[model samples]
Target: MDVLAVEVLRIPMAVDLAAIVIGALTGGLLAAREGFAVSGVLLLAVSGGLGGGLIRDVLLDVPVVALTNPVYLPTVGITAMVTFFFSGWLSRTTGLLVGLDALTLGFFTVIGAQKAQLAGLPVTSVVFIGVATAVGGAVIRDVLLAQRADIVQPGPYNAVAALIGASLLAVLAGPLELPLLPVAAVVIALTAGLRLVSVLRGWSAPVAID
Candidate 1:
């Protein structure tokens, strides 16, 4: 129960590293589809997996754990290797990765909000960081692949779900002052539920008129 900030909850390092693996899974799948070599897979994995935290730390002006931590790079590397090998099977197993992405969405969100809380940011900024942490990696992946950021275009409720999760955390952790683990649980469940339902029901964010 090592605390990082006054009254702010610090999630376990294992959980934090797990989010990186899940995010990198998405990148690894994409690289496999493109027939990239092992090195390229590792690159996209780092970008898609670790980029968000990098962005968050930079904004916070704190040390970058992705680069600094001894365990982080290896975690991403192993994930990329596994994903590259299993890309075929994983692609065939429809909804598996999607479910994982949905499930872990809250992890990144809560961690981002937690970091912002450590920095004493206001609620709005906290929510912003949360969503950024959840989806910033994907945006970087798309950019590196020479495509548009899927989030900017019409898509499902990925960011919206993250927003809801981060906002809930802001409310519970800010005004209500609830316990950290319970609040994080609620946020994660709600965000994942929203995302999963949206995907299953084919819900998409509204776009401008044609």
Candidate 2:
């Protein structure tokens, strides 16, 4: 492994584990709202939680973490359990679920950029991969559920937040040589903050009505 690769590997696996939990929670909440059974919740949880990482690894030409890491499976499993236990409370709040989804998007976007940089991909490629990583899972979830994806529709700055977060990661990686955790933190905070603010302020990209 190269220096960047080694550095990236040194990043605590717990971060990705945490993201998996968050993704599962979001997925479970969505499934419950959609009147899915326990099996459906598990399916969505696994799909949503690991989907981004799987896509990222494939794009980077590496083994998918879902296949290689035992940690990934249990994390989603635990998340499903928690969601199952707390389904009553979580199912009542759609906004909270949306917030978690936005957070997942931010974290995954940063992770994608970091991985791409570690793989020595170009900055532009890293950005594209980051956006895909952030939104890919939700796209899959939506397609599976047969609903319009939030990233594709006008809801908030979902994709924009991912793009900005990825751009920040790419710029920071190139110059500051920041550690993965700090870089991820900054990117996630910025992206999630922008998303929350957009939600609160009704900020959105203007579309020209043809």
Candidate 3:
């Protein structure tokens, strides 16, 4: 593992674990809706849970955390299995899905920015990597399902929320010398707030007319 990978491994386990479970649940539910079998559901869940971090790690030229960490892949598998078995009960809770998605978005976005900053990437690269980490799994899931990538298409401020948080973190923690934990908390709150509000308000980027 590279230095960057080692740094990522030291991140707070709570944040990483929460994000993984939420991401896995989101993917598993989508797979169930798509009528996938157990294997396909597990596949999608793991992809969704780990895909963003893996992409970010690759971009940073670091070892993939999920691949190297025994805990991560197992967490993904267990979350997927639980989501699969309880999907019927979970299906009724749209609010739960929305909340989990927003939480996962926040956690991943902040972690990505933190990791990229530690890797000594430029501010622009850090922000981009943060957004990529926030949505990479969903992008992979959409591609696998042959659907339009929500992050790229017109959507409810998904990547925009990530951009807001990542840019703020890059500014606050990079030059302002703010403490990391407080910055992370604020970033997560902002990202989750933006996402949830956008969903509730039906906010979207302006459409282009040719």
Candidate 4:
């Protein structure tokens, strides 16, 4: 692989790890609030934390992290333990969980875009992969819990925020040739901030009132 490809791969792995951590924490809190047992919490943590990456990798024809990487297992395990140990503290602050979820969404979106670019996918395809990466886990989680997926629901532009972030990364990658870490950080920050603002302000996509 070329130097740029090597650099892209390394940074996205780090970002994926960070996303897993955030997902595990958020999933743990949700599971605790739902009165899940320790096993259930751990299950949710693993599923929610790594589900998207699994889907993304499979779609991209790469090895799935949950099956191939030891790091993913321990990361989710640690997150579950921390949440179980501090259940009381986290159960009281639901907002923090939502914020972390948003951050994870942003992180995964960028990773998907970066990976798509490395895989030689078109820009539009890369953007689609990014959206799938950001929302796939939540979709799986909700299905397991028998709840609606937030990304598809009429909420404050969750998937749209991810699309924007992925597009930004792809655009930046094309011209400026910014390093993956800095580009990923900027994309994640902007996307998360946009989602937070939308949540706070009750923003939503326009609807026709025929």
Predictions in order: lDDT: 0.85, 0.81, 0.89, 0.82
Candidate 4 per-residue lDDT over residues 97-159, each given as its tens digit: 778778888888887787778888888888988888888877777888998777667779788
TM-score, every prediction: 0.91, 0.87, 0.93, 0.86
RMSD of each: 2.3, 2.4, 1.8, 2.6
Model 3, C-alpha of 162: deviation from truth (Å) = 0.4
Tell me the spans in candidate 4 whose CA falls farther than 4 Å from its real position. 1-5, 12-15, 175-181, 208-210
Q: How many pairs of residues collide in each model?
A: 0, 0, 0, 0
Q: List the residue pairs that clash in candidate 1.
A: none
Which tens-of-lDDT digit does each residue in 124-198 have in candidate 1? 999999998888888888888889888887777988999999999998988788988899999998999888998
**Candidates, ranked, lDDT:** 3, 1, 4, 2
Judged by whole-model lDDT over C-alpha atoms, candidate 4 comes out at 0.82
Which 10 successive residues of model 4 have the least lDDT summed?
Answer: 3-12
Q: Between prediction 2 and prediction 4, which has the larger TM-score?
A: 2
Report the C-alpha lDDT of model 2 over 59-172, residue by residue, as the tens digit: 788878688776788888888878877888877877876677677788888877877887888889989889988877778788889889877677678888999999988888
User: Tens digit of lDDT per residue, candidate 3, span 4-62?
Assistant: 55666655788789889889888998898888999989989987899999999999898
Minimal lDDT window, size 10, model 2: 4-13
Which portions of model 1 miss their true places by more than 4 Å? Answer: 1-9, 208-210
Q: Identify the superior model by lDDT, candidate 2 or candidate 3.
A: 3
**Top candidate, metric lDDT:** 3
